[model samples]
Target chain A: MKISEIARLVDANIYCKGNEDTDIRCAFACDMMSDVLAYVKNQAILVTGLVNPQVIRTAEMMDIPCVIIVRGKEPTPLMLEIAADRGITVMNTKLRMYSVCGILYNHGLPADEGE
Target chain B: MGALHLEYTVAPDDFSRAGEVSGIVKRTLKDLGFPPAVVRRTAIAMYEAEINMVIHANGGKITADITPEEIMIVFADQGPGIPDIDLAMQEGWSTASEDIRDMGFGAGMGLPNIQKSTDYMDVQTTVGVGTTITIKIFVTQ
Candidate 1:
């Protein structure tokens, strides 16, 4: 799905417009940056409630195109700056982490391909 | 022969700037047209070590030497060094504060992750003086 479609699907606000036309294949919903770093699932979108530089760091290292901050958490100025510099999309939504993950998963953004 | 040389100074206090160096290194590898697996390994190993430096040692300096055959990363810090390198290398032992843990780090996986991602990793640390970690990821040429 295009990052724009994800924002529309989840009612998210795009904090940074970058690579919006990139199609995301899968998603990962986790607040633990370690897990995100360790698990190489070819996930394209990272949905987490944690707002910090590490989130963007993980995204950049993994080449993830989009980051969704759930529960209306605001991205700090540094986070936005880093995201902008790296050309990674950032979005915020009012829905909680689990709910947002569920909605996106239901809409065909599976967290992983299979067991 | 060394192909590309890079150096970055990690700030001690700013958690926001933790991955700046690793990001640059990753981009450099990408621009050099390294294979995806080799680039990913180098990025992951360097990133984990960078996080460890930020959380455990306050800050440090990272030096990366990239060659066609291997990428070597040296992370040196002057904070209170790891008390027990063996224990610290374990999978679940962590001395990180609650705040660090809350940020989704300090799971005692940094060293192991670095080891896993790279072809080889070595740690040299002194309790009061400082610590320096050297990690190498070899790419099939």
Candidate 2:
């Protein structure tokens, strides 16, 4: 799914648009940066509720191009700055983490089964 | 390609700038034309160690030596060292405070994640002195 499509589906607002047309096939939802670092494989979208600069840092480390902030949480300015600098798209959604994952899953976005 | 060396100092408890060194290293690897997998692995491994340095060790120094065959990274700190390496290496074992946990880290997966991401890992520590971690990720053509 393209990042723009996911934004539409989840009613999210793109805070920093790095690449709206980037296509992603998988998603990993986790607030713990360590789990994301340990498990995420392949280029996928990151769905997280944690609002901090580390979220952006984790995405940059994993080469994750997009991060969806759930539960209407706002990202810090440093987070947006890093996201913009790293060419990572940052989005905010009022939907909870579970709902965002379910919506994406229903739309054929498979979970990133880090293997 | 000729060997390249880089170094950076991490400020203690600087959560805001934790991944700066890893970010630079990741970009360097990418610029050197490393495979995406290799670059990602190196970045993840180094980033985990960098975070540990800030969270546990009050900050440290990270040095990266990059060669065509592999990238070697060293993280050295003078903070409270691990008393039990085996227990520290275990997943879901952490001594981070509640504040750290609220920051979305301290899940006790840092060391394990580093092990999973790199090709080789070596840890040296003293109970009250300090700790140093060295990791190498081979470049596969």
Candidate 3:
């Protein structure tokens, strides 16, 4: 599925327009940035409740095209700006982390290398 | 072709500017047409190392040598060095402050993550003097 589709599916508000058409495969969900860093495997979409610049940095480092901030956490202006500059899509959803991950999984979105 | 060399200085105490080097390096590697997996791994490893430099060592310099066969990244910092590398290498042993943890890091996984995401990792440190890390990730044909 494309990032735009994920945004709509989760009722997320996209803060950036990164590759809306980019194909998204598995999703990695974590608030622990290091864990996210340790386990991310070509997952294009990152679902996190953490709202911070490092979140953007992690997504950028992993070449993740999109980030969906769960739990309705608002990202700082700097974070949004950075994501926009990097051409990475950012979105916020009311769904808590577990429900967010579960919904995506139920929709056939694999988790981390699809294992 | 000689490996494309890149270098960056990570300023100490600058949490906001962390990962700048890794971001640029990632872009350069992608633009060079490296395999996506190779590019991703290199970016992740280097980025984690970069963050570690800023958060732990107050800042450092990163040198990356990108070759067709492999990419080598060396991170050197002049700060309180690791006292016990073995303990530091553990997956969940981090000394980062509570503030850092709130920002989503400091989970004692920086070194481990760098090690796991890279093909090879080497660490050299001297307490109160500094520490240096060398990581290599190969791009197989």
Candidate 4:
């Protein structure tokens, strides 16, 4: 799915105009940066309620093109700066994490491909 | 032969800057055209250690030696060291404060995740003294 489509699907606000055109095949939703780092696959979108620099750092390390902040949380200035600097698309939704995951998963975004 | 050497001092609770060193090292590896897998694993391992330094140790210094064969990252800290290595290495063991948990870490996944990303990992710790972790990731075709 595309970033714009996911944003519309989850009712999120796009905080970065990065390469949203990048088609993502899977998505990983978790609040733990460790889990995100340990399990995420290439070109995946990270959907989490964790709003911090580590979120963007994890995205950068994993080469994840997009990060969706759920629970109506706001990304810190540092988070936004790094996301923009790294060319990562950052978005946020009022929907909670489980809901966020369900919506995206129902939209044909692969949740997990079994490692 | 010895290759690139990098060092950085992490400040206590400096959430905004925890991954600076890792980011730089990752970019350097990518610029050098290391395999994508190698670069990503190196970056994740180093970043986890960096976050651990801030969250658990209050702060520390990291030294990295990068060569064609391997990347060795040493994390040295003077915080209250781990009393039990076995417990700390477990996937779900953590001693981090609630504040650390709010940041989306402290779920006891740092050490295990580090081990998962690197080819080899060694931890030397002394209660009340400190801990030094060395992780070496080798480059392979």
Per-residue lDDT tens digits of candidate 1, residues B1-141?
457788899998778888888898999999888898888888888888888888878899999888898888899999898889989888878888999989989888888888888888999989998899998888884
Interface RMSD list for the candidates: 0.8, 0.7, 1.0, 1.0
The window of 10 residues in a row where model 1 chain A has the poorest summed lDDT is A106-115
DockQ category of candidate 2: high
CAPRI tier for the interface of model 4: medium
lDDT tens per residue, model 2, A1-115: 9999999999999999887778898999998888888888878899999999999999999889999999999989999999999999999999999999999999999999966
- For residue A5, what is the lDDT in candidate 3? 76
Query: Share of real contacts kept by model 1?
Result: 0.70
The residue-by-residue lDDT of candidate 3 on B1-141, one tens digit each, is 667988889999888889888989998999999998888888888888888898889899999999999999999999899999999999889899999998888888888888877889999999999999999998883
True contacts kept of each: 0.70, 0.85, 0.85, 0.72
List each candidate's DockQ score. Answer: 0.75, 0.87, 0.80, 0.78
Best by lDDT: 2
> What tens digits encode model 3's per-residue C-alpha lDDT throughout A1-115?
8787788789999877887778888899888888888777665589998888889988888778899998888988989889999988989999998988888899988888633
Q: Residue B91 in candidate 1 has what lDDT? A: 87
User: Considering DockQ, which of the candidate structures 3 and 4 is the better prediction for this target?
Assistant: 3
Q: State candidate 4's TM-score.
A: 0.94
Q: Tens digits of per-residue lDDT for model 1 on A22-94?
A: 9888988888888788775584699999998889999999888899999999998988898999899999999
- The DockQ of predicted model 2 stands at 0.87
Candidate 4 regions off by >4 Å? none
Worst 10 residues of 4 chain B by lDDT: B1-10
lDDT per residue for candidate 2 within B42-112, as digits (tens), equals: 99988989999999999999999999998999999999999999999999999998988888889899998
TM-score of 3: 0.93
